[model samples]
Target: MNRSEFLQRYHHLRQIDYEADYPLRKTGRAAGVLIPLIDHPDGLTVLLTERAHHLRHHPGQISFPGGGAEPQDNTLADTALREAEEEVGLLRSEVDVIGALPEYRTISGYAMTPVIGFVKPGPVLTIDRNEVADAFEVPLAFLMDRRNHFAHFIERKQQRYPVYFMPWQNRLIWGATAAILRNLSSHLCDD
Candidate 1:
């Protein structure tokens, strides 16, 4: 959707479902991710990054720029902005923090807070090779469309858990990132 329509439709302050339909740990370390929505002429696009293949966890996965909370961070929002700047060279000043979704606890022991931000897609991002290998943007319209989402099941310890996947062109946006987008869709999509 366009900027005006988005702003008018999405009431960030309203109550929303904090957690997606997934088994979550009771406790996990606080983490934050910025769901950067860049304002394009036609519609908004979401900024995503492919994790470095060498990373210890979730290698080569598509994700938002964020990480575990540091002591220096004043809030989860701060953590999101800090990680975004560090991972993608997105300046803090460029992002306008709109709102946040409730925390989604991952199986990997993270209480990931999804911070939604509005940005203009002009800055040349410097991808940190250590954390991210590539950065790309997917149109928000494509992502928010429920038709584009697929359900995949993973068997762990004889239990089947549903994972969401949104394949966009050559990239497969799945796992937590896709789940997060699904969560966002619940908020942004009209009933």
Candidate 2:
């Protein structure tokens, strides 16, 4: 869809009290992730990041640009923007904060808020090697299409937790990142 149409539909979606799927995790630290969309000539593309291989948590996992909310951040939105800037050097000025999805609670003890934004095309990113290994873009249409989504279970101890996986080329987008994408996809492609 075109940028204007997508944004209009997205805004209308946020206004509705659609039931959202949140994980059963009851406790977590507040976190935020920037789900950025760049308007291409034919459609919109969503940006994603790969965590560094040596990190203590979720290393080498595909995820949105984000982290735990620090006290310095005034709100969850600020945390999202700041984390995006720190990890990928995406300036706050370059992002147009349009709207946000409902909270996505993760198995890894993060109460993540997916902050949706539109990014100006062709902004140079200075990726932090310590925090992020790489950054890539996936077609929004591909992600929103349910035919491309798959489900698997992660057996932790005795319990099984569902993981949503959406493959783009060689990259495996799964875990909380994929779940959030799935949620966002449902919100956008409801027509």
TM-score of each: 0.92, 0.90
lDDT of 2 by residue, 36-155 (tens): 998778888999999999999889999999989999999888999999999999999999998888888876778889999988778799999999999999999999898999988767
Q: Local error of candidate 1 at 95, Å?
A: 0.4
lDDT of 1 by residue, 1-191 (tens): 98888877677556666335445546788999999999999899999999999999999999999999999999999999999999999999999998888788887879899999999868679999999999999999999999999997888767787799999999999988999999888778777
As a whole number from 0 to 100, the lDDT of residue 80 in candidate 1 is 99
lDDT accuracy of residue 21 in candidate 1: 40
Q: What is each predicted model's overall lDDT from 0 to 1?
A: 0.89, 0.86
Off by over 4 Å in 2: 13-26, 155-160
Candidate 2 global CA lDDT score: 0.86
The true-versus-predicted C-alpha distance at residue 27 of model 2, in Å, is 3.0
